[model samples]
Target chain A: MTLIMVVDDDLDLAEMLGIVLTGAGYEVDLVNRGDEVMPLFSTQNPDLILLDVMLPGLSGVEVCKLIREKSMVPIVMLSAKDDKQDVVAGLEAGADDYMVKPFDPAELVARMKVRLRRSGGEVNSDLTIGNIVIDQIEHSIIRDGRIIALTRLEFDLLVALAKEPGRVFSREELLSQVWGYRPATDTRLVNVHIQRLRSKVEIDPENPAIILTVRGVGYKAGVPGSFQ
Target chain B: MNSPFKAWRTSLVIRVTGTIVLLSIILIYLAGSALYTQISSGIFDEKLNLSISDAQSTARNAQFQLTFSQYQDKAALKSIFAEILAVPPKTFDNTAREVAIFSFAKTKVRFKFSGASNFLEVTSIPKDFRKKTKISNTTQWGRAKLSYINGRNEPAIVVGHTLKIAGAGNYEFYVLFSLEQQTRTMALILNYLWLTGIALTFLIGIITFFVLRRLISPIRDAARVAEELTAGNLELRMDINGEDEIARLGYSFNEMAVALQQQISRLENLSKLQQRFVADVSHELRTPLTTIRMASQVIYSARDIFEPKVARSAELLVSQIERFESLLRDLLEVSRFDAQAAVLEIGEVDLTALVKETIDYVHPSQDRIILLLAPITPVIVDIDPRRIKRILRNLISNAMDHRDGKNIEVQIKESENEVSIGVRDYGLGFTYTDKKLLFERFWRADTSRARSTGGTGLGLSIALEDAKLHQGEIDVWGERGRGAHFVLTIPKFAGGSIRSRPISAQPE
Candidate 1:
């Protein structure tokens, strides 16, 4: 059984979240304070973390950074304010996804499921995009005969671009395909994640070549075997 | 010329100095001319009196000499006349003295002897002056130009007297005194007056300019400080000096600035506090709302195990909670607007695609109700897409509610600087009076009708705020039973203002 850790300062909300996720056939570990997340997280070894932005003792953004320093676990932040600074701050701190308060619980569960799903399947095929090889069987990328670690979402995004080498994916399309979001939702999610992904994979993130951007349109994969 | 005119209009110091200089010029010219006229006329009178007296004494000497002479021949009288005509001529340094003897016209003896000394032209005396001299008994004098036979001219005073001779009868004796000395003196005086007048007028101009500039400098400083303050530099102030009228102005101006700065800072603090309160309220309320939403969903999922009425109650609870959550969101947005704390997240977006998406989101059914009239090409604009989407959603949903099964129209238009989105509905129309209060928070056209529509009562108000955040505007037009139209106009670029609206709210 897959285990998910829910961290929030509000006890009732955390309890309700625990109830909802347990009903969805996932074992749940609930923590109420941001500072207490790491101890429980290390022992429980949950597959995903549901963190709240505003918490006692430590902020969700700080906790997210702390978690990112140690592990690559998927983190989806729950923010009370839909303000851009708050959401971007969480994302910049290495959160995989975020949901504003008063979000639909069914939608929350659906996003959680997407975040926890593994990209590699029985049909494992090696893919190449801009001189970087995506090894589906190993769930890692090989660049210049060296392995590069990537998050599950980043791996899925790379695979989506490599699978269809010629097609351009709009931000909205990428949101729906990779983040499991509804059509025409916030596109900042795609923009921030793309920046984060480039910082890790590209030689110079300022001028990107692996994920080439089509101006005023969308993003597309660079030509295969074009390393330099 | 244009630059001086512009300076005259713009600079107070230049204007005042120019006016003073002009007035001084006129006054100095009048006074200088008056002084020059008085001095010149006095010199001429003094010279005329001396010439008359000197000519009178010379005429008496000649009369005595002719009377006492023992000569009986015309040759001896000719020698006497020759001696008297040998007076010296005038040079640039010396006043000229010339003598001429003329025979009277009615004399019995006809000795036609007329001669002048120092090569003086006998015709130098005007005929009018000669006639006056002949008519008078005593020595008569008038002003004349003494012309020399050598072609030299000098201003002179001529005096004439009648003389009796033994053989030569009724000879007219004349003495011409040159006025070159007097003219030179007058010219010297005139030069002095000119130099003095010009020096005085220039001094007055310089003094007036400096004085006025010194007096107005404080005021100029005050204007500069005021401009700085208006440009949001709150710390600027005028420099105050001693207690005078201008210094008093400085004091008062500085006092006003202090008060203004204090007031502005106080308001800023109050707005900050209000923003903090709004944020706190949002955070506090959202936590509870999240809890309630999850609990309601849990109960809603288990509604099938309960009684039918409880199940229905659970359904209503879930839906109303959703409504409450939306109301909370709108209230927070309104509060943000009230505190002037709303920020724009600008991005390039396809306006046509956004509108189509909003229409689909609002009305998912295939009723063919919304008719979109737009350019076939995509219309891209820089805007805060979330706010724009909210505004469009409010307008479209409001239309859906009041459309009354009539066809709705959504039109997009673009100009050089602005873009307009117009949503029109032909349904149960509102009165003209309702348009005035349509955007007011919690204001409804018909309370009973609006209550049934399940609107949050803050939709239009928040929509107006959202439009304002983008520096845009919303216009509404409605008439009784004739449907309503709403139009939103915004700039195509961030930080730009709408110059012309592409779509008007008025129906054709």
Candidate 2:
């Protein structure tokens, strides 16, 4: 069974979320405080985390950074604020996705399902973009015979762009393709994640060669040896 | 800074000073002319009196000398006349004197003499004065010019007298007194008068200007302080110096400023408190509302096992919760605007695509009701997409509420620096009087009628605010029994202004 950790300051909201997640056929572990997340996370090893932004003793963004230090587990932040500062801060702290309060439960389940999905049945293929090689079977990328780690969402984003090298994927398209969002929803997710991915994978994050941005349109994967 | 002439229109100091200086100039001119006339006439009369008395004495001496020489022969007489003609000319100590002697036409003398002293022309005296002298007994005096043989002339007073001799007929003797000294004195007096008049007038002007400026500086300070206060600098106050009328004015002005600042800050604190309450209420309600919504959704999903009435009630519960959530969201947005905490997340977007998406989102039934007329190519704009989308949604939803089975048209057009989105409906239109109140919060055209859509009554008001945040304007036109049209125009770039609107709210 897939176990998901729900961290929220409100006990009722946490319990409600547990009920919802349990009903969605996922094993749920409820944690009311952000500080208690790490000890249980180390032992239980949950497949995903649903963290709230405002928490006692530890902020959700700070917890997100702490979690990123140890693992690349999928983190979807739950925030009461739709403010760009709060959302972007959570994203920059290594949250893979976020949902504002009063979000649809069905949509939340759909997003969690996408995050928990594994590519076990697909044929293993090697994809090349810019000067990097993506190993589907190993779930990693290699540059100059060295492996680099990526978050699950980042890997999915790069795979989406690499699968169609000639196509320019708009922000809306990327949001729907990788984040399981409806078309024409929040594009800031795509933008922030792309920046994070470039910083981690590119030789110079300022001038990205792997993710080439098309002005007024979208982004695309760079061909091998495109840059000198 | 205003121009001098323009300041004359707006500044009290300049106008008052100019008026006082001009009146002083006229007053000085009148006083100076009156003084000059009185002093000049007095000096001329004194010089005339002296000339008349001196000529009387000299005429008497000449008559006495001629009487004694009346018994002499022709040679003796000639010597006597020569001595008289050879009298020493006047020096500086004496007034300039010249004499002329002529025989009357009635004289029956053997020797008819006509001679002058010092080459003085005999015709220097006026013929009218000579005629009066010839007929008069006492000395006849008049003003004349003493002309010399060298063509030089001097203004003088001439006194004519008749002379009697024993052996000679009656002779006419005239004496001329020069007026050059008196003329120079009068000119000097005039120069002094002019200097004094000019100096006094300038002094009066300068004094008036300084006094007015001294008196007006406080008012000017009050004006400046008032302007600063009006510009939102509530701390400024007039500077008071003394317990005079101006100081009283300053006191009153400062007191008013203090009162105003207190009132403003009080109102500000109250408004802040109210916004805080609203925000807190919204936030506090959100968590519980979220829990309740999930619980209701859980119940709604299992409604198949319940009775029909319970199922229907569960369905209504879920839908009402959704509506309540949207209302809470809108209330928060309004409070954010009230607190001035709303900020834009600007991006470049395809406006045509955004409109199409909104049209499909709002009325997705696909009955071909909403017709969109836009450019085939993309109309790209820089804006906050969420706010723009909300505005479009509100307008379209509003149209759908009042559309009344008519076709609704959404048009997009662009100009050089601006773009417009116009939503028009031919339905239960509003009256012309309601146009002003269209964007007002909670305002409905006909309050008696039931609302056809699920709206929080803050849509149009929030839409106007959202448009204003982007430096945009929404134009509306409506007529009873006709239709309603709303047009929103915004700039193409962030921080830009709408120079021209691509569409008007009025229908063709």
Candidate 3:
């Protein structure tokens, strides 16, 4: 059984979310205040977090950052604002995904499933991209005797590019392959995630080598021995 | 193409100054000619009087000398006549005065002996004047030509008189006075007059130009300031110097600017207030609406446990709440558009994929009401996905609503800078005239027809605004009983303008 912690200031919404998660065959832990999330999160050690943006003591974004500092657990934010700033802010704070309010409950479950999906690579799996070694089992990247930390999404993005070094992938293809999103949608998800991934993996985020952009088309993996 | 005349026509200063200069030129010329003629004629009359009296006195003296000579012998008479014709020594002074005489023989009148002092040519007298003077005993004067033996001629006045001598034959005596001195004096006077006229015209022109410019400068400034104000610079004002008519105009213009600024600021404040109210209302309403919607959904999950009536009521409640939520969303969008502050978050995406997504979202079931003609290659572009999605959702939902259980077509096409998505439906089409009013907010069709399609009435209007924000447009074609078609064309990039629509609203 998987444990999911739900954080919200609104009691009824929090309870409703608890009921929905319980019906989906998951153990639910509900916290009303944002301040109460951290203490309970460490003790309960839930598999996932469903946090709301607006909270009484701490914001959902701040809570996401606090959680990201310690753990790589999947964090899905629930914000009433569909505004770009709010969504992007949550994503930048290391929240894996977000859903706007008044969203269908089933869609929320589907998004959570995408976030909680396990990477299918075996422990002995080794991938190489642009002179950087990616150890799938250890979930770490090594470049010239230096180890780097990458979130699950970023790691998956790198692997997706490294797995098929020759094939060029558009944002739509990456969205479907990495984020499990259908092709019939906006590709900003791929854009923001790719940026986050590059900032972690690339030595210089300004000029990326692992993922090279092809003008008027899409992006492709750089040739082997390309990273400097 | 630009002639001086044409330039003058267009320029206010040149037109006025040119007209004044032309009038002054004509006036000065006429006045100058009249003054010149008056002075010249007066000087000529004085010289003519002096010449006439002097000629008469010389002729009388000659007659007296001749009578005394007649008493002597023929040789003495000839000697006296010769002495009378002998010219005095030539002087350097240019008196130009000379005397001439012609002696008539008693029986030989055909051969006239004409002699002149200083060898002045006697034939210089006009033939007409000589004939008249010979026939008539009166002393006559006429303008004459003075011919010297050196072949030079000068204009002169010749006064001719005939004397009936007692012994000598008939003698015609005349005096020729050169009018050169009088001509010089007249020329000097005319030169002064012309100089004075030119100087006066220049002074008048300068005075008129400055005075007119002074009067029109304020007006010109006011016109310029007013033009700037009309061009949307509301802070500009006319410079008021004194309490004159022009200053009064400046004051009034300033007052108008003040009023205009006040009106614009007031309207802006009012619009800001309205936006605030809408934002606040949306925030306040959504909290409760979310709770209600979720509560309804939660209750709806266990509908099988409840009675059929209650279960059906719960379903209706849930659907209506969803419709109400969409209404709230549309109202908020319309308010944002009205405030002119709706911003576009542009990203590169495929229109074909977007259309497919909208179809799936609107009609998730493979129902008979909808059909799609999608593209193979992705029509990639930079656009605000959320807004375009909203517009497509509105358009497709509209198609489904009025679909009249008939099949629909969603087509996508692209051009270089513009991409067009057209939704066609073979259903209860509107009248040709109503097509124009279709984009108007809250406009409904046929009160008699069934209101089966639930709409907030702001969807089309909002969609139109979304297209306009992208510098795009929507064209519609419809007719009664025929299918309705709507085409939306937008540029490929943010801040780009639509050049050519890939698909037109007209049926092909």
Question: Which fraction of the native contacts appears in each prediction?
Answer: 0.84, 0.65, 0.19
Across B101-157, the per-residue lDDT of candidate 2 in tens digits comes to 877876587557778888888889899998888888898889999888889888888
Clashing pairs in 1: none
Q: Assess the local accuracy of residue A131 in candidate 1 as a C-alpha lDDT between 0 and 100.
A: 82
Could you give the candidate ranking by DockQ, starting with the highest? 1, 2, 3
Clashes of each: 0, 0, 0
Two-way DockQ contest, 1 vs 2, winner: 1
Residue-level lDDT tens digits of model 1 in B1-508: 6998999999999999999999999999999999999999999988888888889889988888889988678888888888888676556677888888888776576577888898888899888877877777777887788898889998988888988776567887899998888998998999999999989989998999999999898889999999999999999999898998988898899899999999999999999999999989998899899889989999999999999999999999998998899889889999999998998889899999999999999999888999999999999999998899999999999999999889999999999899999999999879867888899889987888777878789999999988988889998888888899999999999999987889988887
- Candidate 1 chain A has its poorest 10 consecutive residues by lDDT at A117-126
lDDT of 1 by residue, A1-228 (tens): 999999988888999999999999999998988889887778888899999999898999999999988888899999988878999999998999999998899999999989988874875778899889989988889988998877788888888888899899999999999999988688988888899888888888888889988888889998987756
Show the lowest summed lDDT stretch of 10 residues, model 2 chain B.
B445-454
* lDDT score, candidate 2, position B426: 93
Candidate 2 docking quality: incorrect, acceptable, medium or high:
medium
* Candidate 2 chain A: worst-modelled 10 consecutive residues by lDDT: A116-125
The candidate maximizing TM-score is 1
Which TM-score value belongs to model 2?
0.81
Residue B375 lDDT (model 3)? 62
* Pairwise DockQ winner, candidates 2 and 3: 2
Output the TM-score of candidate 1: 0.90
Which residue pairs of candidate 2 clash?
Answer: none
